[model samples]
Target: MTDIDPSVYANYYWVSSQFYKFRQEFSDFYKSALLYLAYTSVESLSDSFKLDLAFDLSLSACWEITSTTLESCSHPIIKSLLGTKVEWLYYILQAFNNGDLVRYQELCVYNSALRAQPALVENEKKLLEKINILCLMEIIFRTIPLSIIAERTKLSIEDVEHLLMKSLSVHLIEGIIDQVEGTVHVSWVQPRVLGIPQIKSLRDRLDSWLGKVHTALLSIEAETPDLVAT
Candidate 1:
């Protein structure tokens, strides 16, 4: 094998700095792929650079990026890195990957409070917020009252609304926040890959929905046999 470049480590900042300063040049697909890579690199880099690397992805932007690249960006090493990487930044990445509200909340409550490690306390709070915001869109089904969402997500009522508005502004989900009734009326969850279990659940829901439609159609046929036949 050829000798590796020790000079690259000598100029590590010069190399990693491009990921920060030149983000404008990357397409969203590339940006989304890079988020995971950059997140993984945080521990290896110096303290001063961690937050800058972390904030390169906002909550909604994480969803947007993941949507485009989730299927085909196929990084061979990321799967291996994902499991054992339990550092501060990867916690946020793990939550984003799942889009599971319950899991994300559990992570926040466990790590973001007085129990947080001294070095990780500040970053844990930020990671909790990022995961909460990232997973917000996936939890809506029909109309859910905002109060319950706040309770589950461990956010205040106002923060729930703010998070909803942020997702709406990014076009992550198309929904209405009814202040008078205290409900979030969601019509759609943006398209993204579903894990094996989610796919089964979705399949069951679609079957139930189709059964509802079939019963309605049968009622219409009974009422207007001639019209239906024609």
Candidate 2:
């Protein structure tokens, strides 16, 4: 395996992707191709090939796979992308990884290179849906009002309900929607490989929780001096 040309793997991946595309098995194609790209020695490929592979993988329908790529910045393939024509592609993927709908929209509108991708142009609606789902994941509240979801996702209340239903159906999120209350009570969110931003978000949440606990303890001590041992 060490002696074989890296292009051999790249060529095989490309051919397999085309086969899956022909069958309209987009999810399978993305999963397999991304795994191949992640595991292979992408640095051995030409710079042109690396750029093309990065672009192709960035447009994957599987947000989990594309988003995970952001965590691999140290990988040769991802490192090779820096300071190149497609460097914006890294930020584009970061937007998706961070669930920044506004940034994603800005990139789409302002980046002519992104707009030129026929795959992206054709699947704009699907991409919107994906970004909305990502936005939902970023919400910290387990139980949230539809209005809040609408505000966060930039969707109408009706659309928010539909999006929640779609997310539920796909098992992206485990939750129940209360139509009368216009709220969703989420029990779980699908876990994925975390990138730097997500780790930072987790750290922030932990700090906030600790602060709240300290405040509560102080309040308890002040109000219930008789029950406090200290």
Candidate 3:
């Protein structure tokens, strides 16, 4: 067996520590797969290899059994391991694996929040702004008013409204009122929130957008001069 990479441990130390502490909080299958993967030394492999290993590990653990609700142990394990990217991957795999798509998608949404890290530079900030708009695209189907997104994301109401407008402009989110407030009609919860496929799709879109933003920022930094004349 190869010695684990100290750098992998350094890069993901906090996440790995959290995994260990909360490992038991997860169901059985996820616990087992995560434990196995987490124990593997990422030090020896290239980053690409590590990512491929994660994807392959998920595939190997997933099985064909159409009737199994996403309540299965493997779903969370996949989410924890892959973040939002895995959610879409879960849906793709579901067509082949016979796992529950809806439940797994919902897990992806919660996992999506973890994907929101602070941007290190200006272009990254732009990319996050765009990604945030994309993530909120489904709000069009949500019964709640545009105001709630701000609360959910802890942004000011204006920021939320701005995001909503951007999402609407891009056809990411649309809005409808099934009930009249003065007429006192009851509104049903939109089932969009829990869908595993949607969450996974959203996560992938966000991840890709952020990657571009990060790359753009890096290029800018590379071209900037160290000092400027007054």
Q: Give the TM-scores of the predictions, in the order they appear.
A: 0.57, 0.78, 0.28
Q: Report the C-alpha lDDT of model 1 over 1-230, residue by residue, as the tens digit.
A: 36745444435544444654465433452354354453454346554353443433322233433433343213323333333323433444445656666765566566643244443354555555555655665567889999878876778999999888977887777888999999999997678766566678789999999999999999887889777777
Better of 1 and 2 by lDDT: 2
For candidate 2, report its TM-score. Answer: 0.78
Off by over 4 Å in 2: 1-15, 18-25, 61-76, 218-225, 228-230
Please give the distance, in angstroms, between residue 9's alpha carbon in candidate 1 and its true position after superposition. 21
**Whole-model alpha-carbon lDDT for candidate 3:** 0.44
Q: How does model 3 score by TM-score?
A: 0.28
Best by TM-score: 2
**lDDT (Cα atoms) of all candidates against the true structure:** 0.57, 0.74, 0.44
Better of 1 and 3 by TM-score: 1
Candidates in order: C-alpha RMSD to true structure: 8.5, 4.1, 18.4
Give, for candidate 2, the lowest lDDT window spanning 10 residues.
65-74
* Candidate 3 lowest-lDDT run of ten: 182-191
- The candidate that achieves the highest lDDT relative to the unseen native structure: 2
RMSD of 1: 8.5
Better of 1 and 3 by lDDT: 1
Off by over 4 Å in 3: 1-122, 138-140, 176-230
